[model samples]
Target chain A: MIVCIKQVPDTTDVKIDPEKGTLIREGVPSIVNPFDKNAVEAALKIREEKGGKVTVITMGPPQAVDALRECLAMGADDAILLSDRAFASSDTWATSYTLAMGIKKVGNPDIIFCGKQAIDGDTAQVGPGIAEHLGLPQVTYVQKIKEVKEDGMIVERSIEGGYEVVSVGMPVMIAVDKSINEPRFPTMMGTMKAHKKEIPTWGLAELGADEDKLGMNGSPTRVKRIFAPERKGQGEMIQGDDESEVCALLIEKLRDKKVV
Target chain B: MAVKIIAEECIGCESCIDACPFPGAIVMDDGIAKLTDKCNGCGACADACAVEAILVEETEVKSGIDINDYKGVWVFIEQRDNHIANVSLELICEGRKLANELGTELAGVVLGDGVEELTKYCFAYGADKAYLVDGPVFKDYRTDSYTDVIVEMINRYKPEVVLFGATNNGRDFAARIAVRVHAGLTADCTELGIDPETKQLMQTRPAFGGNIMATIICPNHRPQMATVRPKVMKKVEPDFTKTGEIIRVENSVKEEDVTTKILEIIEHATKMINLSEAEIIVSGGRGIGGPENYYLIENLAEVLGGAAGASRAAVDAGWVPHYRQVGQTGKTVAPKLYVACGISGAIQHLAGMQTSDVIVAINKDPEAPIFKVATFGIVGDIHKVVPLLTKKFKELKEAN
Candidate 1:
């Protein structure tokens, strides 16, 4: 089993500096993307039951080794960081292409796992993109693995109002949802071993990827601008002497809006 | 890929550090601004540079596709159980406006077994043309089969802009097609526009959990693809009198070629808690105190004839099921009336339901961010205020 992960700036860590009119970047901790952690947990569970080695891979900067180390501490057999200056500024298309190359270099596996989406980008495109590049069937938004078989497995994929049970063959890609499992904290022994582990860093040359399809040059989308969203105007506070009066006033207001 | 910072002009003011969205993307190395690998070339740091020390090289790479060949604005018409999904209709309504703005035709791309008759509904909604791919293999929504058909259709008759409903199935197949066709795809766009000068599709979406809004454009790609969540766009009233040109296409994908099989679909057995379709929603949060007190929320929702919802805190605490969660990680809802009880309105929570027509926040703390977006706010305990509101509404219904 191979699990894909990403390191992201914790969304809760993002804050705007009122005085500077800029993001307060200091003291913001970068953690493994929560959804990716869920994916790693799912992969670890499958390995525990199926008795196979789990390999974790990520394509990010050199600092992304920290994220892989954290995954290693969670009991992944091996960790690989595909880091290079050439892989910078990649959109989902290029990111997925690079990750797919890394996956091929790592060797064949019966199953591949990925998080539903990265919190930082929130595009949810990489999982499907990798599946397409590799020409593999994908079951996305998987909430649970109902039953595992030798050649195939039954998984519950989350849909609009509910979930659909799907039977898929091996060598398939599964993108997991947050509802799948509660990720475990790293044990002290595992943490020490993870610190001692030397994760291999693969670059574009190692992956044997085309330079024209590697980074910003290969990305189709471009950011025109990013700004703080305009704040909603101050809302009207319903004033009443008592809760009953407030409720009556609110009901009247709803009626005026034709909402009641 | 590199967002270069010219060290010769470095004033080391650290303005770029503050402006950079990614932490540790830019750092000061010996009183000179330096670029780290964390930079995704967003260019915010360059804009913030006072000394003009930062440079972002924007090299346009052509994907060998003629952009001029793509013309119409198309919405992928999604259906289940032989009924067209409301979100597809909503996109057709939106696509109509975009098509008008672009001076192009609006079309609907439908794929299903015997879904030929559904073209009339698409035409009624707003599409001027319908591309129908009918077959048994196209009945169920499978990633492989759907991507194979749609990618071929897109390559044959190029649409300048393709909009999907952002449903689970929508996101799944759309991503694959976008990658295969080498088109730029944006997810969960709240607003879309055409650049007046360049004629490019401008896609704006919330990032960092609604803390930032980024406008993206695919200048070099042929088809600009986007996925809009349900309830985010309005649908025009149907005009059954309208008719469209139906172009039937063949689906060559065989059942044996598809790798995954849908064994069963199990809808939640409980009362349908579809908050996106609900007119009103009453939600509780950390301030609701405990799981036992959740009945107040349900009672308020019942009295108002609405669905019950919960904040991430409440849902994370296991007080309520995940389906009833209303927030970024949960569901984005734009109801007529959203009553947030004790939900202090974290930015993530507000990102989901702040678009409601009427927002009522009931919390003991007056300074909660929920009040900022509320149409009516009560600075009182949910334990006391929720029941009173429920009682008052019950009495009003009885009197009526």
Candidate 2:
């Protein structure tokens, strides 16, 4: 089993660098994407039950090694970091292509997993894009996996209306949501084990990915503009002498607005 | 320049037929592709034309892309159990305006079994034409089947732009088709407009943790795709008397060919909460305190004849169920009246309910972000104020 992860800037109160039209990452704390943590837990759970090696991979800058080390502490047996300057500025399309080629280099696996969407891009395209690239079946927004049979697995996929239980064949790729499982905290012993383990690193040449499909030059989509949206006009603030008076006034207003 | 399909080099792979999005552009003759008059020289078939058989005249090419070749704006009309999605109608309203602004036709593309009868609603709403692809393969929303058909349809009759509601199914399968067709798709957009100067679609959506809104444009892609959030766009009034043309497109994907199977649909929540359709909602936050105090919210909702809503904080804390959670990760509700009690209003929570027609916020802290969008705000203790407000509303209702 292989789980793909990404390291994203913690965006609770992130600010944009208006001049460069980019996120101000200078002092912003970075963490493994919340959704990717859920996926890592899912992959580890599958390995625990199904009895297989869990190999996690991520494609990002050299600093992404920290994210892989965290996954290692989470019980993943191995970590592969695909880092290269040539891969910078890749969109979801190029990212998926590069990840697919990188995964293929590690050898074919029974299953692949990734977060439903990344916080920075919020595109949720890479998992399905990789599936298309590798010709594997896919399921997204998975809430629960009921069972993993020898040939196929049954999963409850979350939809807007409800959830549908789907049985997809093995060799399928799934993008998991937070509802799938709660990620566990790393223990000190686990941290020590991860620190002692060697993490392998690969690049475009090692993955043998086509150069045209690795970065901005290969990305089909481009960011035309990025800025803060203008705030709307202010709304009214009504106060009253007392609670009943306020409720009465609010009721009158609701009646005027045809709301109650 | 016109597209030429060389019959001899064509290996009868049907790749061209599947790749062409324009209807009537290519047809299978003796298992070989035959180009028809409907071909607009978009040359989408070039990559999939396998054998390098399909050729286009080079004189009119601009950077190897013919932008003028594609025309029309399309709205994906998603339906389930014979009910057309309201988001589809909303998208139709938006798509109709874009099509007019672009001087092109607006069509609603419906894909499902026995859904042909619902195509008239597309016209009643605003679509100039309806593209109906009917079959049992669409009985269930399978990623592989839907992606195959939609991608093939885009390749056949290349619509300049396609709009999909950012519902679960829409968000699920849209990227797959976009990736397959190599088109650009914007996700969960809150606003859609046309860039008058460049003749491009301006797709705006709240991003970066909903702190800022970014307007994305697909400058070079032929068919620009965007998935709009539900209830964000205006729902046009239906014109019952109006009728439109219905064109049936063929999709050869089979059920047995798909690798996924639906064992059953497990609807854990028996009753569906139509928060989007609710006129009034009384939502509580973590400050509402515990599960015991939930009855205060329920009583208030009962007095006002409104549904109960909760903040993600409260839901995560298990004060109320997740279905009632109104936030970015939860449902987006645009009720006529949204009363926020004790909700300190994180941006994620505000993104879901800020669009309400009238927002009344009651918080102990005056600096709560929810007050920014509220029509009325009361800074006070909810424990004392909620019970008093419930009693007053009950009295007012008795008098009315």
Candidate 3:
């Protein structure tokens, strides 16, 4: 099984500087995307039960090797990082193309796994994009794996109202949700081995990816501008000496609006 | 393509450093901006450059698809159990406006079994044309079958813009179709507009947990696609008197082509608490203290005849089920009334339900960001304010 992951800025740890009206990213640390961990954990669980190898991959800068190492420490069999200056500034389309090429170079695998979405971007496009590029069946937002057969597996997919039990064949791609499984912590021995394990970094040339579909030039979407959303306005603060008075005032105000 | 900082035009201003969302993508070197490998060609720095020092040079990769060939705005009318999804109607309403601005027709594309009657609702919601692909193979939403039919339709009749609701099934299949058709798709877009200058579809969505909003455009790709946020767009009242052309397309999707099979579907037994369809919601957060105190939130919701919700923190603490959680990772709700009790509104949580018509925040902390968006704020203990509000609301009902 091949699992795709991304290293993202811990958005929860990010803070806004009120005085400067800018993001205070100085102290904020980067971590493996929370949802991606669930993907890694799902892959590991399947490999443990089905007796196979789990390979983890990511496409980012040199620092992304840390994310790979963290996945390795979680007992993945191997890790690959696709990093190059040419691969910079890729949107979802380009990113998926590059990763699919990297997966092709890794050889055929029964199942490919990924997180539902990354916190930083929250696009949830890469997994399906990769599946299309690889010509594999895709099942997204998988909540649980019910039973594994020789040629296929039964999984529960989360929908709007409830869950749908789906039976998918092998050589398929699945993006897991956070409810899938609890990721395990790295053991001391696993950490030591992960630090020692050599992770090969693949570039555009190594992956045999077309340069036309590699980076910013390959991306179809372009960001015109990005800014903080404007706050609506300050709300009316219902103040009173006691809870009873405030509650009464609130009720009266809502009654006037007919929302109560 | 790569981002380059032209030293000749450099003014030593650091606006680019602040505007770039990717960490370590830009840094100051010798009083001038420099680009690192961390940059993901989003071109935010170039926009932020005061002196226009940053330049993004594309390698002139032609997509080979003629953008002019694509016309009209199409919305994928997602339906389940023969009932049209509300988000689909919402998109058709928005699509009518976009189609008008572009001087093109708005079409609703529906693919399902025995769903031809849904076409009338599409016309009522403002679609000028309806394309229906009805068959047994299209009975359920399987990615393979849905992608095949949708991709075929898109290829046959090119659309300049295709919109889908950013629901689980919509996102699941839209991504696949976008890739197959080589179209640019923006996910969970909160706003959609046509660029006045370029006349291209502009997709605007939140990034970095709603802290920043980015406006995106697909300049070179045809059929600019986006999965719109569920409740962000307003749906106009349906005009049943309106009529449209119904074009029934033959489905070529075979059962053998679908690799995944739906064994069973388990609908939520307690569907009454469906937050997305609720008119009012009372949500608790970390401030609710513990799971034992959750009844206060439930009681208030019960008194209001609405749904009980919880913040991500409350859900993470195992106080509530994930289904009842409200936030970016949870549900995006636009209820008529939203009462946030003890919920310190993080931007993530606000991204989910800030679109509610009326927001009432009850928190002890006056400085919480929840107050910024709340229509009514009460700086008091939720334990005290909640019970009193419940009692008072009940008394008002009794008096009436």
Candidate 4:
């Protein structure tokens, strides 16, 4: 099993001035998304139970190796980083295509696991887009993994009302929700092993990825602009001593507006 | 330009061929609807087809609406058991502001059985007009019945922007209506604005997991549709002196067409801590120590006359059930007063409760992120602070 993770600049760390919509990322630190940790944990648990190697993969700049190393320290057997200058500014479609190519390069695994969505981009399209690109069955928003059989797996999916149990054939893609599993903290032994282990880095050429289908050029959706929402009028706080008085006060205000 | 047909694994269903309202557009080929040039792309055929075998390509054509052409901004007034949901009233307040900005009127669409009395209340709140759809079929919310009535009114009146609360019933009804009318619908909007340049409704909402907000626009669609979350907006006061025109809408829905039967309506017993509807909420985190200490937090919440909540970490630790968890993975709450006891306030947790009117934090760690948004910060043991606050509240209540 191979799980792909991304390192995003901690949104809290990035200072944004409300008056001026600009991000100050100079001193901001990046971390593996907290949600993706659940995906890594799910993969490691499956590898332990099914006797398979869990390889972690990421596509980012050189600094992204830090994220892969963290995954290795969490008990992943191997880590791979897909980094190249050509892969910058890729949207959800391009990102999924690139990751799909990277997965193919690492020996077509039986299953792939990913976080439901990345925090920074907040587009839940990547996982579903990958499933569409690979022509594989997808089970999204999976809250629980009931069982993993030889041919398929059963999962509890979170829907609008409650939950639905679904069975999907293997060689499937899954976008795991945060409630799927609890990620374990890296131990001293794992950390030491991770320190000695080197993550193999791959580029577009190494993965045999199509240049046109690898980055912004391949993405269909383009964001024209990003701006903060216009604030509404100054709100009037209703005040009174009792519920009836408050209700009366509200009624008075509404009478003025002709709204009963 | 040629229209593209994206076939989604058709099972040779002839429903589309029989249901295409347009003449000669669809023909039966291999027991499936094969498209021809006569297809007008009106999508009535798609709606009638049970198999979902038809797809229509929409072109991005800009339609200009004269600023003075539209008269009023209306909100769908949703009610349960004859009483208005807080969200509907909240949207009316919001719609009033938008109507004022556009120099127009604000109206509320009230559809129910014997809800004529609610029309006066709508005018008292902020509505300049109340469109009432009263009938027995419209008594309980059924998807097809409500959609048909609402769509009929929208087609006749042609309001500029329509808003719905993002509740289960609201979303279901709104999605069906939007699909029926071939209009763009933005769901779970947190913010709404009018573009000064284009007069377009800018609908903003948390896209992923409250990680980033995206603003959407429907330039070509008539009567722009948006579904706002409950508690994200304020409800205005009702004024009896204010008056509006009460327009009675006759419903044409027959009892037989409604296939779903309501066997029995059994409402669940009210929860002790209804966090979603609470005006004030006091939540505990993992730092509360264990499940046993949750009682201290609950006691404080009771004294404050508020509901108790828990962080995802505490909930996952078996300290509380998942419903009480407040974060991206759990429920989003915005209350008048939010007290965080021992919460570290991760970004995900903040996403849920950052919109509270007033936040008070009590954590042992002085550097905890919860303090950043806390109006009152106490760096001490929650066990100590909670008990002290509970006792103080009791004394204050007794003195009063």
Q: In DockQ terms, which candidate is top?
A: 3
- Which of candidates 1 and 4 reaches a greater TM-score? 1
User: Runs in model 2 with CA error above 4 Å?
Assistant: A15-25, B1-65, B268-280, B298-307, B332-334, B387-400
lDDT of 3: 0.88
Worst 10 residues of 4 chain A by lDDT: A223-232
- DockQ-wise, the better of 2 and 4 is 2
The local lDDT score (0 to 100) that residue B366 gets in candidate 2 is 89
Worst lDDT 10-window in candidate 1 chain B: B268-277
Model 3 misplaced stretches (Cα beyond 4 Å): A255-260, B1-59, B398-400
Interface RMSD of each: 2.3, 9.7, 2.4, 14.0
Candidate 3's residue-wise lDDT over B142-249, tens digit each?
899999988888889899999999999989888998888888899989899998878999899888787778889889898999999877788898999999999888
The residue-level lDDT of candidate 2 at A21 comes to 34
Assess each prediction's global lDDT (C-alpha) against the native.
Answer: 0.87, 0.81, 0.88, 0.71
lDDT (10s digit) by residue, model 2, range A1-260: 89999998776556654443334545778888888898999988988887999888999988899999999998889999999877876777778888998889888888899998877666677888888888889999898989999998999987765678999998989898767888998888889999998987888779888787677655655554444555545766667898767767777777788877
What TM-score does structure 3 among the candidates reach?
0.94
Residue range A14-108, candidate 3, lDDT tens digits: 77666444566777789999888999999889888889999999999999999999999999999999999888778899999999999999989
TM-score of chain B, per candidate?
0.87, 0.79, 0.91, 0.77
Order of the predicted models by lDDT, top scorer first? 3, 1, 2, 4
Model 3: what is its DockQ? 0.64
Q: Clash pairs of candidate 1?
A: none
